[model samples]
Target: MKMSDVAKLANVSPATVSRVLSNPDLVSKETREKVMEVINKVNYKPHIVARQFRTKETKIILVVVPDITSAFFSRVLRGIEHVAVKNGYQVILGDTENDTDRELEYINLLLQKQADGMVLLTARQDKEKLEEIAEHFPMVLACEYMDGSNVPTVSIDNISSARKVTEHLIQQGHTKIAHITGPINVVLGRDRLRGFQQAMMSHDLEIDSAYIQEGDFTFESGYNQMLKLLALEAPPTAVFAFNDEMGMGAIKAVKDSNLLVPNDVAIVGFDNIKMASVIEPNLTTIDQPKYEIGKKAMELLLNLINGEALQKKRFVMKDELIVRESSELVKNMP
Candidate 1:
């Protein structure tokens, strides 16, 4: 049935019916319920194609991630989906697989009018290009952050959290601490490395160059880097991996060598993913509010889409360092 027909039966004007169908939050609960009852009883379904043609807007959102299979991104995706479905928007997942060309292809969907807006989980594009896109389109960055660019972003304070994790190792008497870093192309990775350096410098600990290793935020990379660290004549007493996958991989590397965790080599990880707690010798890590970051990113994108002014462009969420068995103090050490 038509909206006008539904409106007539509900004894409400067509505008009221439209408001109820689209922006239910604007209507009073009682009125909304009444309109919904009539809608359900009559089995009224709006002509989506016709509505799109009239508004020149697609009620669709694209959420692009570097890796869709990542547990961290999956949690964030759930939050984005929750906001999109509640606001009558459908979400499309674009897994770019950390490829810049693939990322641009997914972004092209917005340019082609296939989607209304985007929530970028990671961006491989340059600052100027991203700025230009934000100026002309509805976009938001979640988790991945750019330095000094006015792209609306939602993320945790990576530097401070990284410092906290490193300082925890220091407090546990880990002087020769090693670090596995994520790719330094993004600000998240650089800030985390900076935090680690800051904590070490502040404690007057000499950072061995050999102890710092670059990882690609993957399990295999962590395992490989840990192997390198283990081969060093003066191996580090503790190691901090950029993400949980890598941390678990490092733990596996240590176990394979017949070394006991916290007794021989303590380990710390970032991103408190689901597997962190369940793994043997639970990982001590930085707990980023992944779901909240996703929800906020989608909210910001909605505001941008509606031509509403944002109070601030950058939204920094809180992060906590979870102390677990993996980084516990060595009882025999002074």
Candidate 2:
């Protein structure tokens, strides 16, 4: 019913109850737990508007994503929501659809005080502008980040992960390997491409310019790019797509061409989304901890909101290479 009722039920003063609700970190852990138990038992919901009026904060977080329809971003959103709800904050999704102007519009909410903080799933703005906003507002970058910026970020090392996946393909006795890259403009895309190159060069294999096609991390883009690779005079024996959607699209292209996966052309991908495992031929991919990245990003933003110092600006999470059916070919002859 009321916070006072909660306070009475918890046997704590009204001020203590307020502190526990508004600023749980300020209260003792035991006391905070006691207050929370009573509040939960009584089903007490705080007056959000009134609380905002008192604290000059909305307790609202805005998470901006480049593509809302993506399963990878959706998983990340779930993790962010889980943390936000536990900490008495609400999450609002801002789907930018890879539009820079639309992304800026969402950032305006943070500047206008409509949201207490923001977690940018991807940054489309210039580095200077992003730094300016991070300097003034509680913000953290998740999944994607800008180079040479001090903004707090939670992400896996795309370069290293990409290299590992490519090396896996190379080690399987495939010298002719192709890469379907993400948009080269994005940091992750560039890093992944660089890693692919690194692996090829290290193995003394040459990368044909025609074998490299850029995709927009979409199913259509992947599908179209694979067709180009398939039409080449000397098509690659194996392919590595920057993301799983592209990998699946490539598999489709291969099938339509009357070729078999791994038998004719092995394939690998990044971001081990749910569909990767369920596909006709399970995709071998790099598993980025998307949900964990989202959770850590929110935690970092909360620290910024509370004026707590972060131990580090860059939060590099670990990634793993998952071997699956799509790239299961073992070449008996090179």
Candidate 3:
């Protein structure tokens, strides 16, 4: 049966009928029960496609990620789905493959009316474009946030977390430490690098240019950068990679060079993924609340969708350091 038919039988306005079906919370319990009763009797199910033509909303939330295959992102997506499904919304994932063009293509779902709102995990678009779209849409940033924007975001304090991890190594008596960082252009990469620098400075350790390596947040980059560090005349006893993939790569590189992890070279990584513990020496890294970040970002987006005001535009979650076999407090392991 049609929505109009359901409204006529329920003796309610078409808007009321739509609210009861699409967003039951917006309708009072009395009105909702009455409409649902008529809807059940008539077996009314509005054609979702046809309904979107009038309301300009598809009741779908688009989630964009850099790499869908990465297990790190999988956890976050799970959290987003949990809340979206519970709130009567659907989630569509878009893999940008680290391409800005691909990201923009999926973002068109908003203007094309294929989705109601968007949640971005890693934003690669221009600030001007994002600012323009976010001004009139329900959007939230997760994991990676934009600089100089009012868009709501949920993420761990990358700078402080990185500093804490680096300090952990220093406390273990590592005087010459090295770092493998993600692309410095992105916010995550830059903030993490800054944290490492600050930690060295706090301990009055000399910041050696030879110890810093730039990585693209990939396994290959991690392996290659670590090889360079291992070849140095004065190699570091401790190394920190931006993510676990890179950290694992570094561990492999050290092993390939006939060196032992946490013995010849202690290593630390970020994002304590499943592999962190499964590795030979295990990994000592920072654990970001990936799932919680996803949940909170989606929750914030839904609030914006429902026209709710936010007291804080940014939500900072807690990040903890998970110490394992990779970064033990043994200095000069022979």
Predicted structure 2, TM vs. truth: 0.89
What is the lDDT of every predicted structure here? 0.92, 0.92, 0.91
lDDT, model 3, position 86 = 95
lDDT of 2 by residue, 1-334 (tens): 8888888999999899999866789999999999999988888998988888888999899999999988789889999999999998899999999998999999999999999999999876999988988999999999999887899989998889999999999888899999999999888889999999999999899989998999999888888999999999888999999899999999999999999898889999999999999997999999999889999999999999999999999999999999999989665644
* Model 1 error, position 285 (Å): 0.3
Give the alpha carbon lDDT tens digit for every residue of 1-334 in model 3.
7888889999999889989877899999999999999988878878988877877778899999988877699889989999999988999999998888898998888767678899999877888888789878888989998877788889999999999999999988898999999998889999999999999999999888999999988889999999999999989999989999999999999999998888889999999999999998999999999899999999999999999999988899999999999998785453
Q: Residue 232 CA error for candidate 2 (Å)?
A: 0.7
**In model 2, what is the error at residue 91, expressed in angstroms?**
0.6
Ranked by TM-score, the better of candidates 1 and 2 is 1
Which of 2 and 3 is the better model by lDDT? Answer: 2
Cα-based lDDT at residue 135, candidate 2: 93
For model 1, residues 4-101, the per-residue Cα lDDT tens digits are 99999989898899999778899999889889999999999989898899888889999899987788987899899999999889999999989989
Candidates 1 and 3 compared by lDDT, better number: 1
Per-residue lDDT value at 292 in model 3:
93
Clashes per prediction?
A: 0, 0, 0
Model 3 TM: 0.89
